[model samples]
Target chain A: MKFKAFLTDNGVSLLEKRFLPALDKMGRICHLYLTKDHAFFLHNLLNGDGVQSIAQFRKESLFEDYRISSQNDDRIAFTIDLGLLHRALRSSVSVCGHVTTATNRLQVKLVKKLTHNSQQPMPFLTFESKGYKSAVIQDVPISKPLSRVDVVELQSAIDMAQDLPQTLVQGPDLHQLQSFVDRLKHVGDLLHITITQYGDLHLQLLNTLTTLGVEFRKLPVVGVQAHVPSGDQNMTAQSRTKYAVEKGEALSVQVSLKHFAKSLQCHLTKPDCAFYGITPLASCLTVIFQFFIPGTRQTDKSISLHCRLPVLDPGSA
Target chain B: MSSSEADPDIPDLVCQLDNVQGMVDALSSVRWKRHQDSVLELSEHGIVVIVEESGCLQAKVYLKKELFVSYEYRAEGRPRFGVSLGVFVDCLNTFSVSGRSSSIEICYPGPDMQLLLKSVDTPDACIYAEIRTKVPDTISWDYNFEPAGSTPLSFTVKSAALKEAIDDLEWPGSSIQIVLQPDPPCVQFRGEGHGDLQIDFMYYANTDLLIAFQCDRLVSYRYKYKFLRATTSNMPGSVIKDNRGSKLTIGRGGMLKVQHLVSVARPSTQHPHIDSAAYQQPSRIAYIEFFVKPEVDEEPVNDA
Candidate 1:
């Protein structure tokens, strides 16, 4: 069985600039699972933070072809170093590249040869899975294919993230929001974020010594129907509420001033950035930064970054 | 896109340059470990960063206000605070990606406040860091070397040659020994531990490589490479290639001064609106200096 993605420099930048920031918000490694129609990236962390799954729909126009084996239940999953893979993705100088899994190794081949350099070999980078390697280099980490149970956990995490209630924030410039939170942190380090029933996202810096709060009021809301948001991730949601978020229904999540600031990094590169906050009552809090690949022929090549951070409230702990 | 167009809120301190690598390189001149908790003081002039080791050796790097394309300090008083050096660097590095044009603005409301960095260029991304101001003065080792006055031996040399000479030396030594005299080998650099290895650097009358060489009386000084090594490791190789000449001045009482300009100025002819009178493109020099105190000479004092 073979799965291929015609990786373009844009796609590689998507992996380098966008993908790494999302993982930087979460864990060190991620599991890449490829099915017949789409590529699903799953991360189920052990630190009780929650799970994250980013699904990229196969755009035939952007890709040479995204093909999976026709055999029954042939979905393949392999673990990779999120940071290292990002660097490998960026190492290619070609407009076109190919990512293929064969002989138990995932090879990223930069297929576009530069006309100026005829002496250099066709550049390709490979990642060896523990399942494929007979001997291991001491201390160096070796990635392995995901086990059946690991797949189950990641799928459950994805379903849970989708099943969870998410609030999309608008109106406030992220720079302002970030600065406000950062400033309040000096007085109090623990930041408590709450979404009021009136569609306002309330950010509060709370500690035993001081309490400061800011309310981002009346952010427009999209309809309740659930699917991956429009591919133009940065575009502000224009669809006025045919449905209003339940009033008085507030879900709050507490995080350190540092963690909240670190998670906001993914939005730096995208000018028109959109932020979505996912807080499921009390377990953990997740923030999704969405952006789109600017140019594509037939379809929208969009990416949604989901980062889960532990909600370590002193009272809760 | 320019920073003003990016909608980064009314920045308390907004400064931009063609690139940020020079400031990062300048900061490298200062030692890191001992100065970790020192509050980074921001004034109308620029950031005042003082890095010191034990009460004897110290380095101060000033990211001058002029170097910034635009600098606005809204804070009333001088803001003194310490931020995590590693975390702060990580935020600025986001703009270091290739082909991605970037304009950076650093904003903070007051001292002990959160330091926010917004890059209007690439992806409009921003980084937030929690700066601790309460412990700004925790690193209180202030050594007054008084490097401003006249020195015994002062000379300028190409940064590349000095770096190569240091690199070429068999570094298996405890400390570095430097000797400047009026003899044939005008300047001698030695590395001594298991064995003594010495190299000579010659002076030229007029050349870009060796800008100037001023010799006073004969003098020899020895310093622990460990402290100097920690400081030099931060010099990013990219800036050295810009051919910014370096000058080494050994002052009275083993006080050593190393000064170099690192910024590569875009020609003044290119900027049509640049106030030539107010902003002299040639005067737009980004200089970094390291004042290293020579280690106490352990050799017998009466010996020749």
Candidate 2:
């Protein structure tokens, strides 16, 4: 039977309960790859010299080289034929793998395909007995949503803002402030929905949402700026005996926000300028602009950094 | 699964939980274990005293502690005392379960006649004692010896026993022996009168890893009576019979023999000792001592 990699928790459970047990009962376990967790439990079943059963053989040899870490978005697949499954199951050793099959309605076409290219190509034998019956398996249920919420929210917000006034009688600054607040609330709502609905589904949820369209902007804070040290142009003979020394300083980014209660920097924080060693008056460095969704808040103070101009040691100079 | 349809090979009951009850039944299945060890000592006078070594003829003899020997001439002035000597130890082989039983052997080949050897096996072999000898002044001989033993004895649970209960098997313990003799035999009032002497013993290890020793202590007393002091102005009726010869053997305990086959429950119980985090890290070795006696060279000497 053809096999597929289990991607979801339900899919994994189905593979373990239905597929693995069926294969075990049918005794077709050789040449199967299982996840590390599953292989750990099944390793004791396989038979070989030093290997007690197929489970052990797969666990030691196959899993070591073939088992992929589930942390990555990679898929693993396994395939098995019916005749082999029948022979393996009938053997005394315990067999386990994906998709077990029983041989009842004999077909030469299917039988020949089972033995084709196999390491040991042996003839098929009838494996029917009293109380030996084929195991029945069912597919697991999964649901997929037709549309995402962010797309609807964006469209609705755009349509609702059309009737708002374009004039500045109340004050243009106040009008812009109100518009910005409205957009911020709309974005935050979208973020909450995206995080809740798809967060636990898979690793690709966050990346996928970003690709489809979602954004978070960090709030501005004080940040560091870099500058050369200011000193007296003249130096004593002893001070001049060696090479010149270069120093750096940090400065804060100052910006005027009309609605802000006090003077606020466009930068992430006042601490940012000092972190980079730039002094308050150092204008050599410029504040950088960053874009994010309105819902994103200032998690930390931003820092600006620059290296000190190289100063050569006296002996080297 | 119905009992009738289940594979006949599968036991009627496969109760993983019932194994504990079976273990409780085996609590009384006591298996005995035995242990033994070999001990040897070297005296400053070149005498080797071996106690309950692996086998027979494991003994220690004292020759010269610092190679300083004074001469005492006989009144008749015959063969002088202070003869250079060497003691030879034949073998110190390990005891085998299948081989013929063997014990320690000590020998003294000297000019003097009459030798006496002694041995003792103390319970637990834990006592630390010493043996002293009385001999005339200026007697000397060099010797060497090794301890041999009966086949090494250790306990292992049979496969059948393991299938039932592993705790029924016995475990071994450590073995130790002490030399019951003075440090250097050359000093006055020691075994200074005797020469060409040896001792040996057998070592055994039981289930508890303790070694039991069967040691034989032997002394070779040799002397000659002369008429007068020939070198120092003729004197009559003076005898120069002095203690001059000795030999020694060094025996060490063997490594503990470990069982390789571990039953399911046995591994769960014993593996913790080997698997614990305390032993998982690397550490330094504090100190190590090796005691092995060299064989005697018996090349004939010239009598000028």
Candidate 3:
């Protein structure tokens, strides 16, 4: 029974780029769920600001070489301190490393470059010795993996979160979005975001003292058009045009500015992105953010990050 | 002020600040967290800006006539305008964002005039903002401020020390109990939350921390910690601000006024040797007065 995983530069880069932010959104506490096929990370955000996020990557897509015996049936999972993981990655000189799972500990092998030269400063020696690279392995202890019931619940939640209907605000380019966020930065944490039937997305901020709102009217959107909520109508049909508020009334959700700002951060990474469908659940408002960055070669980076913003009032519906 | 340009409207007046940017920056530093709008009063004696917080607090930042290079106003009586502080600050900081320090000229045409701000550096575009001229509710700038009976207790402490005392308080605290005494262990701060936090600072008549300490009677007053925080958070932080520190003056009527000292940076021009490394840029003394009214129901615990 042989099991070894070679982490490539691409895998490390993916973690550096995407998974790290996901960790931040999830309040630096998340589970690294790994299988033979791919790696899945998930976390339920804390604070009244309900945000849940999951990042998944196919093993073959990110890793250059990964070998696992068919005899192992159970998927390896561990609760990782995201901040500590980031620190370890940063401290590792090579950044790229391999991970081989053991019974109780997860082994991480980071290739660190050690420079050996004359301890003297020589002006003539423009070219020094090519640094010697050595692999330094650090084994991190694994925490308790999720039980069967927890895994089932996590899967169903992810499934229910998939294909959510949302109305994306249109017209304003990335620059406008950045300015809008910057302008509203001083306002309190609770951001009241509203979408009307006429395709106006209004970001409002209010506290016990003052109220301020900015409206983005006739925003561009995907193919889905705003539809009215029919009396005694199909729930599925209503969800299709998720952005639609009641007639002459706006459907508004108060979300944590910090979490919402994290999703908007996606716009910074990729200019062409959409704030997708929103599903207001009992506990959180599930918002899907889809990013499509043009790839250099064959496969482009297209990923959907789901952020569950906690509903201030569960009885509002 | 340059006596250069011409515009319409009678009783028109204009002025340029020595460091116009200084005036702009001073006006912008006003953190009136309570209200979205503040009243800006313009007279021949410069501009007086006032903002109220949570109804209980009123703040005034006075940019006097002396600060300007040429102050002139021909308008009948002192014309006042209510302006959104955030928007006004945004307009003032536009040139700063463009990486150019600007020379500003403020123009007032008449009572019903829109405030016009022209930048010499960015001559291509100037900001013209509508002055909310006739809002009566926004004109609560003047407060009697006279002590009712007793000589109001006064003390001066380093902004850094006061900041530390405030920070030492545990969260969820509602009231800040300030104990001022004339005897030993002169001043003490008490904050009540889940538990009580007490910080005692010995008072000296003249020191870096305590510039002035005058408490004729031992008086203790409790103020809303939140209101105090709203003002202290925007204080001229001890680091960047000049030597003059913050002063706390508690009135007999329980008006807790904290004057945070601010040194407005002025561009160097008086010195001939621009190349001199030690030629320090001039700084004008300014202060933001945060007057927080105490809870009417709470009685002062007098140790007199």
TM-score of 3: 0.50
Residue-level lDDT tens digits of model 2 in A1-317: 11122222222222333334533432333333233333311111222111111221123222212234323222122334423543433331122123222422111111112344666533232222212343322212111111224324322322332221111011112222223223223111211100011011000001211101111111112332122123411432112212122221111221111212111112211112211111223211111222222246442212111111111111111
TM-score for every candidate vs. truth? 0.56, 0.14, 0.50
Candidate 2 wrongly placed segments (more than 4 Å): A6-40, A45-317, B1-294, B300-304
Clashes of 2: 125
Q: Rank the candidates by TM-score, best first.
A: 1, 3, 2
Off by over 4 Å in 3: A1-3, A45-49, A67-74, A92-133, A170-186, A197-199, A226-250, A262-277, A280-287, A293-302, A314-317, B1-24, B27-47, B51-59, B62-304
Give each prediction's DockQ, rounded to 2 decimals: 0.03, 0.00, 0.03
lDDT of 1 by residue, B71-137 (tens): 8775556656565554445334433333333356666532334565544443322322333334455
DockQ, structure candidate 1: 0.03
lDDT of 3 by residue, B1-304 (tens): 2111243444345776435445545555566453467777776666778877667777778776656556777665666666677655644543232223456666664334455554444322222222333353734567657663566678888777777677666464788888888886377878877887787777653366776787777777777887777666655442235545678888756778887655444434443353232223222545577788876553546545
Report lDDT (Cα) of residue A280, candidate 3: 35
Question: Candidate 3, residues A1-317: lDDT per residue as tens digits?
Answer: 23355545555555655566546545666766656776666666222334667666677645544554433344545466666665555444242233322221222321223235746332110101111343444433334555656655666666765645444444345455555556456546777666544455555555543344444545555544554444412322223224355342345666777766665654533434445333534345554444444453332433445566665653232
The sequence of per-residue lDDT tens digits that candidate 2 reaches over residues B82-187 is: 1111011101111010112111112121112111111112111111101112131232222222233332222222223211121111111111111222222211
Q: Which parts of model 1 are misplaced by more than 4 Å?
A: A1-50, A54-161, A169-275, A279-317, B1-21, B31-35, B39-47, B69-130, B134-152, B204-209, B264-282, B298-304
